[model samples]
Target chain A: MKNIFYITILIFIISSCKKDGAVTNPSSVDQTYTPTPYFIQYPFYWSYYPVPIPTNNPLTVEGIALGRKLFYDPILSQNNTMSCATCHNISFGFTDNGKQFSNGLHGEIGKRNAMPIFNLGWYEKYGEINHRFFWDGGVPDIESQVFGPITNPIEMNENLFNVVSKLKSNPEYPSLFKKAFGKDTITSQLLAFAIAQFERTIISYGSKYDKGILSNFANFTQEEKDGMSIYTDIYKGDCWHCHTISSHFFTDFGFHNNGIQQTFSDSGLARITRDPADMGKFKTPSLRNLVFTAPYMHDGRFKTLEEVVEFYNSQAYLGANKDPFITSDKHEAGLNLSDYEKKSLVTFLKTLSDSSFINNPQFSKQ
Target chain B: MIAIKKSWYILMGFCLVILLYSVSCKKDSTNATPAPNPTPSSQKYSLSINITHFFGDSLFKYNTKFINAANDTIKFNKLAYYFSNLKLTKDDGSVYAPETYFLINFDNSSTAIFQIDNIPQGTYNKFSFFVGVDSLHNHSLAQTGALDPGYGMFWSWNVGYIFNRLKGNFGAANTALTLDVGGDANLMKYDLPTSIVLTSNKVVNLKMDIKEYFQNPYAYSLKTDDSSIHDLSAPGISKLVQNSKDMFSVTSVQ
Candidate 1:
């Protein structure tokens, strides 16, 4: 069995190299290509359940490397002007630097804020609904969601078939694809798989919060500790309902009708579900990188974390479709937090910032 | 060294054959018991769906004058919709549930026909079809072909497919409506449990009476002059739910 596997690998390498024009003679490319399997090392906080890997898109070093390259490559765009990195720069924790709505090709602004792509494999599936990506959760898994920005009129605006044609004709993409997927062909499915595989590896487990909570290695200051208590405590800040303390991925991945607006210009989750009740609802975003991914909300309505806290403290709108967690919080009167409590909460939210993730050499655009 | 390599090759080839065989064993949907007597099995039959659009008693044509129950004149160049969750039941209480979804434009030739193949030859009664994409598939994943977002059947902002798109002209003015009827499964489900039968050498024909949408329970009137809702949100969504039931009819089985 081992011999056969080795022989198959040898054949795959030789054929792929010949197809890629890397080798003129078959004998020159006969060495077997055995890829190092990449396993997702789960954070100690998530010790209960194992990280799930799709059988068809299992992570390998080659695939992750390819995805990282595709992520930063402008070739995926229509006019070669914008890449995934064009909006989600590594320095901003894979988000646009404080941009409300990201600027796409042709200087057109997008409707929703660019969500930081990290710890996506940890997205808690909301009951039967899979709100995999984006603000409205229109696309399901990462495999399907990857096509959205590329084709949106105000976004990248590139056609899917045209993008495939461009990648197929590209000089280097074919060989890179072969190394990642064990073939020289480039399809939309393979392209999405490569990108999604890379995204799953963008885990932010080395945060100060993680170290303090899991290993007891890092100690938080008094303000941060008070903030942490407010964030987790049900009686106080009431933030843990959407962003849990026990989990490394802060978000519960459920859509919530937060009291953002009384009358919404963006229908939000309701626009996707067509449910009147889902109006002004957006997916509960991860709190892990709140320091970087600002202004907040789907429309980038809030400019600062202080504003976000202030809104929750006093201005949480008592809309009909407001999430029960908030509405039931003394009938949508809000936490009515004191200035000190609000300040502590902001300080606690900052502890989630993982400088290690942003500066990870493996994740940066080379 | 050569002898060792040859033995390894033979063992590896055997393992490969086993792996291939194991894979092929897993994908059996129709598990019909084989006949005890050696005989050539009854050949499986194929089914295809044909949709014809009608405005009231008159067959709908591009730019042709058609009046509704409201006495409002409307002429449409294209009337398109999405339909899925086709289940065909046999006389013996056996059901064949096939995952087939289609987006059809009445004016276009390619979408006018839906070919469903590979069925055990028998008379089938009670064919059911949904007026929109099923709730299970609607939010499950991004899909291609008929359900593909690239087909413009998908909602760009939200996480659902635009189940129906009614575009083109009404009277002298252009009437375009992209009706995205999506909600919780219970609210959005427009299931039509059709009572029809198909026998040998016969194809099932479905006629979509577009005028019936404006009649009776769905008396929602529309004028060509009425601008597109732009955002096809609720209140209008209720109209679409009613339209789904009224639009479909099993015209013929022969």
Candidate 2:
């Protein structure tokens, strides 16, 4: 009986000792931790400007993981019912799902269509002019762009200070922040850094067009080939002047007035630059992933790819600040493409879609 | 009984060992702050620039009414500006640049004085500084310290710091007056002559007359002229940038 009593005490002692070890030390919990560096794997064919990662905020495994969680978490919103993924759904090529404008927390409507997010890592210092973010190129870089949606009254509608406090109060976030940034104290700057790191990693380069280019049209359909010719032909589609294919990044990454309207209501790039010459200018969006991202244009005025193709083919307005390419003599009456040609152009755009990018498990919510 | 006591002692010893092992693990996790590199004390001396704001003959304080050369009554509620790339020219023409940026606000007295710890011992006769951030640091989004965007001096939409901001009420009607000056074109540099012998710790006192921003070359009327100037391309911006160069003067050196 005495032996039995001693054995029970020994077991209790061992178990109790394990529990003591599990108790977290408050001081040690706040200690500085070095995070592992995360290197992005660019495709061998892609030769562009180096990714504009800020020297102060390098990509790290822990930082990216924390950012992914923040991107998906609704804790950033005022009502905690919306997240960045609410508007930038990964399955929709990181765009709003077939919506003209995204819906905010209080059922408020956004002014512009949510631009799809991809290939943004390459949009930097394209030439003499630095490539900027947003439809109007208002924000200078991706890191600065994170501040816009969070504070905009029609978007997430959350104050930055409140967002920081909310994240700090969460039971799980403090530790995650400590692991990522080496400090438990969360600031808006660090939050921007973390989210920006995750965004730079959301790359897309596995489209059918990419494959066809590599094979020298070996796998391309005859219709797709004809569409490509029309897209490049200045007298036909005339789209390649701005959305150049040779650069791999379809958009010129410059602001231009595409002549969507004769009299400007939005005042696009002019609002940022305060130059009347820049009136009605908007960013030239990438032609990639047309299948997933629809309801096109800055305002999402066109619902289908057919409408977008038709608008550019003949309906582009001849406005005061319209790009000279559209106002040139050859495009005086527009491309005036036939039904078959229009269909071919749309077909060629669809070839740029990459299903593998949307289905990539790394980009999906955990 | 003796055997049972022996086993009890062994179990206690094991429990103690586990406790100590857990403590050591905790100690290993606690990161030590790295020590700063030591510099030779004899070769360098600390220098502090003390700035004081004035409205004409009186001390400048926020929300206090003051008359300008335009003869308009102005009460400033907010006044903040940036100073960067500060360099001191020794009597021999050699320059000693401390390489720092400062954002000073009239509301915050603590920020009015900035110190340079490692100024090589010499006799400095002239000093110069730019009124705005350089083009490179102005455009770079990732910044910390005084240049951090959280300070509310940065324009998030345009991605540049507001070089100087003066917001207040003017005229009898209390009309709103705001002048947020920024842009690479308007970054003005001022070279002021001063005499100082730096062998040890020294303080250089400087005075910035708020009225100087309204006159000297151009007279700005708050009632008739543009009361709000946020854009760099505004008509009266060049006048304001021109007037900023004459605002600062060395009052004393000790």
Candidate 3:
């Protein structure tokens, strides 16, 4: 297999040239190993139907670096000071600065508004597939959705066996849980498969409008190319039939009722499928760092994107399971846009702000 | 000496072309595909399912049998519930469903036992699953498994989907039927659905005995901090069509 990947990159460039004292012969580290040709992969958002990594929790880079240090360690919470980045925040891009509600741990609050943990390992299943996961989708696997904010007594009240005995009384977490589970004994199903392998590496692709549409760069200027031809008109933003944007996480993850809320005091996705045609559905986030997440729906309550484009340009009263492309008037669900096309569609959604995925030093934690 | 014997015959013909390119990469590492069937068949088996708690079950506890308007018998202290949509039929109607299925949260002391281990050999029979939570995931939202409302099954200011969850304690007439069956938003838009089919494979190890279903002769039980055994957490329609006809049924797969 490409000479054992050039003898495992000549044993990690002869152990990084003997941890940098440079050149420690072994035939000059096998002539500076240049054998990078071997491809036989598969297992990155894996799915052929209801199956993805369950041969004893496969994916591991030391389990995404011990699930990115238990997702930025608030010591799995019970007032250790709240973590999963305090409702997912890698500088507003991982999301939460919008807050129509947030407060957890004693100050308590939280009814919704946190969404933005990026790509989510290419999502085949996890909420909106018959709703389940807060914002009332309820919950079901993304490793039991981080066990409802660690036993939520208003979120992160801890106790999955005392967060597996405070991750086996950490001393560098029992050799990083024995190098990601060869047995250091910290279960809760290996901390939900190392926080679902650091949330499938939170891949957002690298935006600036996806490298200016994959590369011809510097080209989008007629009002950000007519707001990307009116944001892919599936008849004026039938919004790609559930906020979709082609491939990997722009969101077709489903659930709607873009007419946010009206009357039904919180029956989102009709309270997890006892359907009245799913009164006030939700899930459809991901516009990809829509200029750093936002106070959008699911109760973050439109803090601005021009008040969610004037509430879809007044396609207003969407009660009773709306969405026939927001009651079809050729996708003009409310686009009366002319405040300079709402500042050129919020400057083409700030070219989908990557900012190196909010400064990714390999999704920093340490 | 003839230029050092022609440079040692070009370094012994470059070590015979690196030993014929390491024997043609050991014939392409013998074209893979080894490692399958990593031993696990020391013949040990036990698969059982038996959970029946019905006292008129729903329609607001239909047929009301956890008794005590002076009828007697209500002895439950805590009975854990939650069955998921699972199907494994194959008498040639071919079905194997597992988009996601989990049963046995019943006060999770390591999920009592809904055990399913590597079963591969061929078979011939039936096995359909889904005691509740289907209207495509019962009113969709806030779920974990057993439709989580922190596994109090779910109702939390009412949404729907909690099908038949029974809680405990009712002796000495204190009155506790805590039977949290499910539905509302008009029976999640009208009811009349219930399923459970079984006849399984890999040999007859399927025994579903919740003690022969509370020995039913119109027998169902309940009790737990009883204030008329407070129908678990208000499931309306007397606990959705009487706990979907008093908790599911389909015994005998010996």
Clashes of each: 1, 0, 56
- Say which docking band candidate 2 falls in: incorrect
> Each model's C-alpha lDDT?
0.72, 0.83, 0.57
Tell me the TM-score of each prediction against the true structure. 0.76, 0.82, 0.30
Q: How accurately is candidate 2 docked according to DockQ? A: 0.19
Ranking by lDDT: 2, 1, 3
Candidate 2 per-residue lDDT over residues A1-366, each given as its tens digit: 657655765575555454345556554455456998998877766755566666788999989999889999999998998899999999999999989999888888988999898878677656214338888777777777787788777888888778888998999999988888898588888888888888889888899998987899788888899899899998898788789788767888888998897789888888777789989999889999989998899999999999998888888899789999988988878889999889999899999999999998878898
> Among these predicted structures, which one has the highest TM-score?
2
Q: Whose DockQ is greatest here?
A: 2
Model 1 Cα lDDT, one tens digit per residue, B1-254: 98899898878876765565444333321233555673333555678788777777777777777777666676666566676778888778888777888888665662377778766566566777776676676663345567755565555545556666566545444555433455444233333445444444456777777777666575666652232543445465566566556677777776
Q: What is the TM-score of chain A alone in each candidate?
A: 0.87, 0.89, 0.33
For candidate 1, the clash count comes to 1
Report the C-alpha displacement of residue A237, candidate 3, in angstroms: 9.3
lDDT of 2: 0.83
Q: Candidate 2 lDDT, tens digit per residue, B1-254?
A: 99999798878866765675555544433433455575543468888989898888898888889999999999999989998888999877899986688999877782389888888878889978888898887865456777866566766666788889999998889989999888878897888999888877899898888799898798988766678987755777888888877899989999
Supply DockQ values for each candidate.
0.18, 0.19, 0.01
At residue A214, give the lDDT of candidate 3: 52
Which pairs, if any, clash in model 2? none
Per prediction, the TM-score for chain B is 0.72, 0.81, 0.31
